[model samples]
Target: MHIKNKLSVAIILALTLGLAGCQSAYYKTMESFGYHKRDILVSNVEKARESQEEASEQFKSALDKFSALTGFHGGDLEDTYERLNDEYESSEAAAADVRKRIDAVAEVGNDLFDEWKTELSQYTSSKLRNDSRVKLSKTKSKFKKMLSAMRKAEKKIAPVLNVFHDQVLYLKHNLNAQAIASLKSELSNLETDIGKLIAEMQRSIDEANAFIKDLKKQ
Candidate 1:
């Protein structure tokens, strides 16, 4: 690798290690307050679900703004562009939060599963050990499913954001009735994409709820 590339890799590794250390310290602090990794994982999953839910609404709102532009008749085109821009910005923020929350859930969940697996050997009774091992396996399986769903939804956000970004940029350059007409042609495809995105988000939210319920039960 080139010198600059090696330095970039070193910086990335250092940041990764720093974040991991901070997360470990935070977990320890929470444990002191009687909150285990399992509890934190559940909380993170819930937050992730909430973020998706909010993102779903924000995306829908952005779509609505985009759709309204199709019927633009004798109004200030600049004002309409501003509204769409605001919605796009809000959608971007919501998508970012969803990604952040999902990462948080994955972090705590991996830690919880790792600790659970390690502690299984400490059990004096073979029966209890086997039982815990089975439960851990089931929980891990469910978590993987939920995380997959979250990731599927997360993947959908970017394309929709890209489309919004393009439209917003196009409007910024050409804020005129003719530009609105051009955008009108793309509305159908955007609607279809947003529809799919919202559906996937709902599926992820449902999976998160199911995982949280199962975790609390166990």
Candidate 2:
């Protein structure tokens, strides 16, 4: 490892820890290490896509567990409630991660666009400045489309979580076959909601991939 590269790594690590709450400082430090905002934006988009994928799977798993309650055959109701509660909690965590990743993408994207727009004034060549400006506009347009898709998917998460939370709370209080039977009635609607959520997440993931590819080409 080159000494310069090693030092850069160390500095990045220090900034990551010390400036965890200071995005501007962190981005500046990263830029100093040759990782400009465009690169960071691409990386964050990849992360957001992966998070959505994971979240989709987690929600599916939770739905499967929830659907299982419909077939309750008089076993340990407490155990059953505990399992469902765990699934609900896991889904919540996954949703939070998806939101966090999306926020990271948005932050880096905003910074990258702002920097690009600001730097256009520094270009003395009129032709080159116009070219850069056009590229910036195109990139911003694509990013907005992708971000909108991501947000639409994110909005679907809350309603599903709310349903799951309600069911989990009901089960926790009334750990009986009757309670399970009651929940069984809601399974179809829950399934439909989850299906919509997964579909929206897939759309978002696809948009992210398309944006990443387009950005890399530029």
Candidate 3:
């Protein structure tokens, strides 16, 4: 097989395995409810599900647009097309799988949220009971696991974009100055967006962890 094909296979396998592990981790956290925080975690899980869907759509659109722009230009487009198609298919599959995992996680989170709501209702009805710290700790760990899983997914697919970005750079170096400038500008924008997206994801995960820690003390 081509090197590009091999890379795609490896990436797909890594992403699939990591996300599956993430699902299992969340399940375990739900089972160990002493440290779980249902409300915030459920909200984050829903956000994660949405993120996965958005990412997948973005990946697909990029592939389609890139192909339209590059196809029939006839300069080693075959190889590039093959590599890109492989990357797109693999990434899409991984993203879809992650969304499925998120759905499962969300179900557990919703169940826990209902329980918390009932408990909070009782707390409001009577004297506020002592807060449970153990559940908070478990929630923090579970959030970390979700973050780690997302990081792994990002690592797996970011390389393909990096490769494409580098290719654009090479094109800029060899192509017409006007064309090069446009490509460079677009590539720069894409890199910026990717960086920003990753940063936002990290921030969300961090916020979840911090929130869980605060809940632990309550």
Q: What TM-score fits each model?
A: 0.90, 0.94, 0.40
lDDT tens string, model 3, 1-218? Answer: 99677656654554475467764454444344433545435555656655655665566566555545433344554455455456555555655565565555555555564565466545543434335334534654565566565555555455646645565455535553444345445655555555565565555445545644554564
**Candidate that would win on TM-score:** 2
How close to the true structure is residue 67 of candidate 1, measured as C-alpha lDDT? 92
Residue 74 Cα positional deviation in candidate 2, in Å, after optimal superposition: 1.5
Clashing pairs in 2: none
Cα deviation of 101, candidate 1, in Å: 0.3
lDDT of all the models against the reference?
0.89, 0.90, 0.53
Candidates 1 and 2, the one with greater TM-score? 2
lDDT of 2 by residue, 10-127 (tens): 5677458534687777776776677778887898899999999999999999999998888878889899889999999999999999999999889778988998999999999999
lDDT of 3: 0.53
- Stretches off by above 4 angstroms in model 1 are 1-21
Task: Give the C-alpha miss distance for residue 49 in model 2, angstroms.
Answer: 0.2
Alpha-carbon runs more than 4 Å astray in model 2: 1-19
In Å, residue 163's CA in model 2 sits off its true spot by 0.7
As for candidate 1, its clashing pairs are none
Ranking by lDDT: 2, 1, 3
RMSD of 1: 8.7
